[model samples]
Each structure stands twice: as structure tokens, then as C-alpha cells.
Target: MAALLAAALAVTGCTAAEPGAAPRAEDARPTVISVTDGDVDLAILGEVYARVLTSGGYDVQLEIHSAQDPVSSADRLLAGEADFIVGCTGELLADFNPAGAEEIIDQWPELEEEGVGGFVVYDELIASLPSRLSATDPSSATSCDDAAEEQGLTQQVVPIFGATLFDREQREALTGITRLITTADLEDMEEAAEETGSVVEAVDEWVLDNEARSGGAFEDDREDVSYLYTP
Candidate 1:
């Protein structure tokens, strides 16, 4: 995971501006922008806003929070800890009462309209010798090698797969797969990787259709997926 994360940061070249630089009082800086910690989905949106804000001469401070708990985030805002909080519009509507906050900027309509959330993949690899087998779910009780042994599939299949931002957890739940190959993974792959969206949608549809063949159940809770976006 660390390696993948490092690769992602390297690929995106995400960085903050230099510290100790005094903000120009007349520069129309954004002052601050609060965000949930390590949200790959939100990061995509945040990066877009960050670039625009910077170009507009705003000295943006990206605040990483533990979660998008509105009450907590609003407390920070009320305390003057943050000038703006970037999160799901649903969360902002619920947590930040428009009557209470001085202003609100809803970005959900823009995000959804633009299809901002990119595709993600969870790659599962074998970590043993002979390396003759690899499967999505290691805990499947039925091993890939066992199936291969039964069917005489000697060639090792890398099991390259992908999923959308929403279905990632569902795919993980079915296969007991822990590691995920996010947009960051493709960014890291450089010449070897293609756009994650195309791969994820195709693989996600394939997984849905081949559930019986894969011996995996589709028990993804839609509510959990919703929480990824909602505060």
C-alpha cells in the first residue's frame, strides 16, 4: 500500500506551495480548504479546485481531516480554523446550516455532471514460489491453483482487474482482497498503464457477469458506498 501510495504521489506530482511566504492581503487568497484524510476520490476534486484557486491567486491550505463528519468540520470552521471545507454537497447541506455559515459553495452538481470520480483497480498477486497460481480472493477456501489443478490450467493468470470508485468496497468484500490499484497505480505505471476508467468499468462489468464462475457473492452494501461520498 505504501509503495502504491508513493507511486501515486510521484505520478501526480502533488505538492504544496512554499511555507513562510506571507499572504498578500489584497491577493484574494482562499485562506484555507479543509478535506478528509487520504480520500482518493475527493483528492481528484480537490486537485481540480486547488489548481484553479492557485491560478486565481489564492493561497490555499489543504486541511486533511480524519473523516467528513460535518459537526466536527463545522466546529473547526466556526472556530476560525478553516475558511472553507471541501466535501460532499450532501454533507455540507446536512452539517453546515446555511443560516449559520457565512457562505457555502456547492460543488456536487459540477462533480457529478463532469464525472469526476475516476476508476480504481484492486490487483491481487501471489506471494509464493512456483508462483503458478494467483486469485482475487485468497480466503476463498478454494485456491486458484486447486481450480487450475482440477481443470489443467497451467498458465499463471495475473488476474488484472478494476472497479469504479463506488464499487471498490463491494469488489473487496466479495474477494477478501485488501490491496487496491487506484488511479494512482496507473499514474505510477507510466507507459505500462492505460487510463484507469476504461479498465475499471470493463473489469467491473466482467466481475458482475462472472460471479458464478468466480465463486464470489455480490453482497456489496449500497449504503456503505454512499458513505464514501456523503459526509
Candidate 2:
């Protein structure tokens, strides 16, 4: 995972701006470091976010860390090494409050088969989080039941971040991404990477195509992404 992250970063050239640099009015937002776990799917989700934020005129970096290591993404955020992360609600809640997560999971036994809204535990999950961290609105691209069967907990993809990492506009922009991407989109991205033989190119192409189709507010730049070809 570390190696893969390094490769992605190298391809994207996602470096912070030089110190003491003057900021243009349109690009004055603070630099953002988006972190993710070892899971490839989450990493892709995180990349999609980093790109959207970048399109919104912020400098963003993506980092991947081992989920179970002492130096995890949450640890990095707590230590101020990162600003935000893409996370699944139930799994994240379970990490922080296992007993509470189990209780919530137990309440919903018959999971729905179609795309659904937020899980029963979402509100509780937000309320239980530390004051320093905040979660954005959950995505309906996945539901608790499907996540429970595969991950033992509800796993809706959402952005968890430092409480004040983004201002109102930035937060809204991030939330818009959750609304735009769906489970089928994730599958398409994965399949595109396989077909193109270059994960970086595949993601870039998908983002471009989707932005056009959805008339998305965000604009994507191929030059901003470093991975044009697989190593």
C-alpha cells in the first residue's frame, strides 16, 4: 500500500506549494492533505476527492497508510500530519466505539438490497465522534446492510476531517462529491483501470467524462495528475 501510494503521488506530483510563496486570490486556500487507509477502493475514493478539491482551487495531497498500524490515518489527523480522510461510517464508528457499533448493527437485521440512504448508526456515529473531528453527510451509494455482510458494519463512504480544515464553501464542495459519485461509478473506475492498464489514466479519464456528463461544477486537469501510465 505504501509503495502504491508513493507511485500515485509520484505520478500526480502532488506536492505542497513552496514556503513564503505569494498566493493568488483565486488560489489562496490553505493546502489540504487527504489521507486514506490501505484499501484500494478507499484510496481511489480519496483520490477522487483530492482531485475535486484541487479543481475547486485548493492545493491537495493524498497519502495512504496501513489501517492497523500505530501510525494510521486517524493518528495522522490527530497528530496534525493530515487534514481529512475518506472513511466508511460503520467501520470508522466501530474503530472508535465497538460496543456502540455492534448495538447499532444488531438493530437492523434485514438489510435492503437496493441503493438506500444513510444508515441508522450515522447520526449516532457523528454524535459519538471526538469534538476535534467532523464527518460530512453520508453517501447513499452504499447502505449499512451491504457493508455489514462484507465488512461487518455499515460502510457508507464519507469524508471525516479536522473540524476546521475547510470553510463553508470548501465543505459544500466536498459534500457535492459524495452526492455525485455512486457505487456503479466506483466499479466503472476499477474496470477502466483494468482496461486501460494505467490506474492514473483511467481515473483521469473517468473524472473528465463524468464532469462533462453531470455538468459538474468542478473542472479536472490532466496535467495536475502525475500518473499517466502504469509503472
Candidate 3:
């Protein structure tokens, strides 16, 4: 996995900025970023982030890794080539800290108990890897039922960091974006994306609605998510 990540990053090691088509105000110096992750679904989520932040007047450049695992994607962030990377809890746990991977098991106690959005357990995922490789509905196609008992383990998705140093303002931007998504909302958005014939548009609309919400699920009272990654 590490080698694959390295190879992928090496092949695509360059900043990809959004064109100046809808450029921000003249005084605006948007923070250019390359958002990356392994899954296409997560890539769409990155687009959601880009759409929301851009509308909020933040200069953001979005990039999709077009890969299947986030190992290299996170590596992109740590290397300063990308500003943001989002991955599932399981993916973050394994590759968030290349120097101290054991921290994945130590932190994120919720992974040991249950995953957010009813994500199946890791062991079960391993058990069904062969079939999962070809499954259409990736999330629900897991063979994590009675057949894979005693091997179930949940892996929730979350943003992680520690290896990178950020200035005060960058730090604020990084930590300020709270978890605005829920399981049902995610499923609905996924379906809507398919129905509307445009995943990017669906995600953009959802981000706008979430931003418009006042003190809703993703609001001012949101909490820090670093603990989900660090000890």
C-alpha cells in the first residue's frame, strides 16, 4: 500500500489549481489547495468542501486523486503538495501517521465500538474482500452479516493531521470545518447525485443548504475532530 501510494504521488506530483474562470474578488487571494482521497465518493465530498469554501469566499483549488486508497492521498497533504485530504476512519487510522501507525488503534475509540454511518467492520471487510472487489454498491455490499461473525470491526471516516505544521490562519481554516455530514444525508445525496445526473451539482447544492442552516447539525457549536486522529 505504501509503495503504491508513493508511486501514485510520484506520477502526479504537481499543484492543480482551479482555472481563473470564476475568479474571486480582485483583493481575494484564495488559498490554493489540492484535495485528494482514494475513493470517488470521497472525491465528490472533496468537491463539496471546495464548493462550500469557495462560495464562502475562501480560495480553494480542488483535486481528486482518482485512486482507491487514501495512503498516498494523505501523503500528498503531508508533503505540502495538497492542502486537504479526507478519508474514511479506517483509511485515516492506517496512514494518518506513517511514523506512528499504532496510534490508529489507540486513538478513535469509536472505531472499536461502532463506526459512524453503520460502516461495516474491517475484519469482515477482509473476509469479503474478493467479492467486495466487484460489488456495485460498495458500502452495502459488504459480507458482514452472520457469515462474517466475530470478525466485524467498524471503520468510520474522519480527517486527520499531526505531521504537518501550519501557520495560525491556516490552522484555523483546517480545524474550523466541522463534520457536516450524516449517514442518511450521505445516502440521500449519493442517490440524488445519480438522479440529478451530476454528482458535483448535488454536492454543491447540499453544501449550500448546510451552510445556510443556522445552529443546525453542522454549525457554530461544532467541536474539534483532531481527537479522532491523535491520541
Candidate 4:
């Protein structure tokens, strides 16, 4: 693991594409997914997805939201300004209107108003402190009145996003990729990213360890591409 970590750090860390490094696109434009917001776990998830996308031979560009709000990010996605978004905290919205959204299970009352309600997008469980979350977890309850009744939350849940990728192929490729990620596993990668000061390095190590479970989501056919992210 240490050797893998070191090697990953070397390859991806402290390097940028040399001047005019690209061979330039001669065919159809490479698909662009504008993943947003720089919260630690959100950024980490984006980086993980970016890694997977590049592995499948799609060109990806990651950008921070200048506005950094879910409404704006989602608007961007619909407008085609952004392709993907990893939303966290203030950036996400829990809608109170229309009586629809994902439900966030095991959620705290105080936090009920703060999270996006309706559907949980990832498989990571949001921790007692909300340091962890996954795609499969519900977004959170929509109504505070409803929450006080249904909620058994000692902790708050974070909303994880489903595929939402613009490219049909990338979306299809990542299906069933969610695996159970314990709090310990999340912290391990997060701590490693912080220690190395490299989200890419830590994610690379994680992908190496978990790829089989992900159905080769991290396997790279395009050697020329690499994506960088910060949390």
C-alpha cells in the first residue's frame, strides 16, 4: 500500500501538462463534465468520478463553481455549462415545494432544513457528525413536521449524487459502482489526502484497492490523461 501510495503520488502529484501537451481533438469533442464545489468529501467524490471517466477514455474537465450553489450548479447542468456536480452543505438545497425530493434517513431535526430532501445518491453512510455519506442514503426528509416523526437521527446525513453524468456512456459505465464505504474507509482516504496534500494521490491508492468491487471503474485505457482535484 505504501509503495502504491508513493507511486501514485509521483505520477499524479506536482505535475501539470507541459505546454501544448495535447495532441488536439480531431474527431468529435471529448465529453466535458463540470463537477463543482470544493468541499473535502464532495471534491473527493468528484476526483473519484473523474478518475473513472478518464479510465474509460473520455476527456474530462473539472471546474469549481464560481457561484458554488446547487441551484446554480444544477442550472448549469441543464444549461450545458456544467456536466457533473458534487454538491455539499450550503451548495445543496432541500426543497420544500412540490412535495418531492429524496428522503434523508437517520437525519437530525436541526439539520433537516439544511440538506437536499428526497433521494440519497451514494452508498456511503453519513456519519453521526456528517463526515461520511454515500449514494444510497436518502437525501433527507422534506418537512420538519414529518422529520420529527420519522427521523431517528443522532447524526445528520449528507446528500450523495447519482450518476447525473451528461454522457450516456459514462453514466452507463458507472452503474452499480457504489460499494459500502465505512466511516473508517472514508477517513483513511481523507487523512491520506490531507497528509500527502494530494487528493489525486489518495484517490489513486483507493481506486487500486477497490477497483474490482467497482468493476474496473478505475482502469485507464487512456494513458495520456490525468485529472487533479482539491477538497
Q: Which residue segments of model 3 deviate by more than 4 Å?
A: 1-38, 68-71, 98-153, 160-177, 214-231
In terms of TM-score, the best-performing candidate is 2
Q: Which stretches of candidate 4 lie over 4 Å from their true place?
A: 1-28, 66-71, 88-173, 180-183, 221-231
Ranking 3 against 4 by TM-score, winner:
4
Residue 142 miss distance in model 2 (angstroms): 2.9
lDDT of each: 0.31, 0.59, 0.39, 0.42
lDDT string for model 4 (59-178, tens) is 666554443354454455445454445443222333221111223443434344765332231222222212211223332212122322433322222323322222233322343332
Candidate 1 residues 1-231, lDDT tens each? Answer: 322221221211112222343433323433455555433333332333333233333355555566545445445554555544433322232333432211212343343356541100011112221122112332211112332343221112122111110123332332332223233332333222135533223334433553344333222211111112223
Where does model 1 exceed 4 Å of error?
A: 1-30, 68-71, 97-231
From the highest TM-score down, the ranking of the candidates is: 2, 4, 3, 1
Clashing pairs in 2: 11-226, 11-227, 12-226
Best by lDDT: 2
Model 2, CA-based lDDT: 0.59
Give the Å error, residue 59, model 4: 1.6
TM-score of each: 0.29, 0.71, 0.49, 0.51
Candidate 4: what lDDT? 0.42
Better candidate number, 2 or 4, judged by TM-score: 2
